[model samples]
Target: MLENLLPPLNDHNLPYPDTIHPIVVHFVIAMVLFAVFCDGVGYFSRNSKLYEVSWWNLFFATISIFVAVMFGQIEAGLALAYPASESTLNLHTILGWSLSGIIAAITAWRYVLRLRDPKTLPIGFIVVGVVLTVLVCFQVYLGDELVWVYGLHTVPVVEALKEGVL
Candidate 1:
């Protein structure tokens, strides 16, 4: 069968080179944080252009979050996480999924706000954006811990797991 000729999974637990989740997630994070910054500045400065920029950023972020989440799910499944990393991984997974939905909902709400007023944004929206940024930062911390502290899918970690050293 052709399946027998396929390459083995790498130390990263992927068929290809490296993890896609972190790459995608970083983009999503940038978009979200940048969008929030744009919203805050636009709201304070009464700058319509920044509001437009913020809206587009949020819209794109909403779309990108799904991609990020999909890759995160796939990579997490392949990670073969050990006990030390399990709790953090579980929380990250749960929060990642939750963030995808929340981002979508926030984008929808932003759409309504944009339609109602193109030149202005509500302070409440900016407040919510800040809160969302906080949550995103927390998610980032969890992800960082998984990679740096727990060493879930790194080469050494994978080798250790295979050799029963972990």
Candidate 2:
């Protein structure tokens, strides 16, 4: 009965065949990297204006990461995993959640710093941003492995699933 109300699952076996996770996650990734970049430039150039840009980027990223994680959890759960991809998928899922937490924590820290002194951002905080940037790069690699290497939810994989070959 509920099936009657819902749209048919598409090629990816999702109500919408296209994955929302990637679309949203890319934004999160971009915002995070850009925030870090802005912070780094602000630090090196001693440009207070870039700190404002960095703060806004981090603020938006904190909100967007949650959305990305929500879609990621849903899509990951729906993804068909073969033996080879299973472990990688598990790692990706764990790291995705970890990244979300890290982003939120960093944002909170930055918020505190902003409230304490808006005129200057500490070098220590900039270093932390660098660390966050590294983690984000690693996460991007894992996500790429899932989509590019493992082809999760791609056309061929979906076809194989339909044929009970995977």
Candidate 3:
């Protein structure tokens, strides 16, 4: 039924569509994880240098998130093979947008406060980054559920495990 609304699925065995399986999302996810670690270091060490590095990570994440959003949007149109896929896609889209907003707000806060006083920044970083990290974990789980449960998309590792594609 839902398949009637989508383009005919191509069975030519082409590598996954560019939109559904872009390489940049991989790099973006890595950057987000690295940013979380940097934030952790900054919070624990209370060092200005570490805090600055954390801010940079957040900045990178914000930019990458935008790119990921674009690719995800394009992929959504192509991957509507089942009804469950649509629900998972909607959930992922909401989580991604919320996470992007949180990361952007935190990055802006850190940047605007960077020069005024070094001491005040730690508490802000500790609070915001910690909260954002927790949210990121939740988003990660939503992403997993989208892929694993709904069968909306594929990652190389999962593709290998499920299909022996490696």
Candidate 4:
């Protein structure tokens, strides 16, 4: 009865053929990376002007990451993973949640720093930003593996599922 109300699954076995997670996540990834870049440049240039930009980017990223994670959880839950993709999918799920927490904590810490001294950001905070950038890069790699290698939600996989071959 519920299926009757829902839209028919598309070629990807998704209510809408395309996954929204990747689109939202790409924004989160870009914002976080850009925020880190702004911080690094601000630190090296000893310029306070970029701090505002960095703070705002991180602020938006903190919010966007949660949205990305929500879409990811929904899409991943709906994904029909083959045996080989299961471990990678599980790891991606775990890391996605972990990254969201880390981003939120760091954003909170940065907020406190902003409140303490709007004129200057701490060197330690910049260092942590560097670490966050590294982690984000790693997460991107995992996401690429899921899409490019494992082909999760790809046309062929979806077709196989439709054919009862998956």
Compute the lDDT for candidate 4.
0.89
For model 4, where is the 10-residue window of minimal lDDT?
A: 8-17
Per-residue lDDT tens digits for candidate 3, residues 65-119, read 8887777766665554355456667877888777777778877877787767644
Weakest 10 consecutive residues of candidate 1 by summed lDDT: 6-15
Q: Residue 25 lDDT in model 4?
A: 93
Stretches of candidate 4 above 4 Å error?
164-166
State the lDDT of candidate 2 residue by residue for 1-166, as single tens digits. 9879978777886878599999988888988999999888888888888889888988898889899989988888878888899998999989999988999999999989999988788889988998998889999999999999998989899789779998
Number of the top TM-score candidate: 1
Which residues of candidate 3, in runs, are more than 4 Å off? 1-22, 118-120, 154-166
Q: By summed lDDT, which 10 consecutive residues of candidate 2 come out lowest?
A: 8-17
Model-by-model lDDT, in order?
Answer: 0.90, 0.88, 0.65, 0.89
Give the TM-score comparing model 1 with the true structure, all chains together. Answer: 0.95
**Maximum-lDDT candidate:** 1
Error at 86, model 1, angstroms: 0.5
Error of 2 at 28 (Å): 0.7
Clashing pairs in 4: none
- Candidate 4 lDDT over residue span 34-102, tens digit each: 989988899899988898998999999999999999999988987878888899889988999999999
Q: Residue by residue across 24-78, what tens digits does model 1's lDDT show?
A: 8998999999999988887888778998888888899898889999988888988
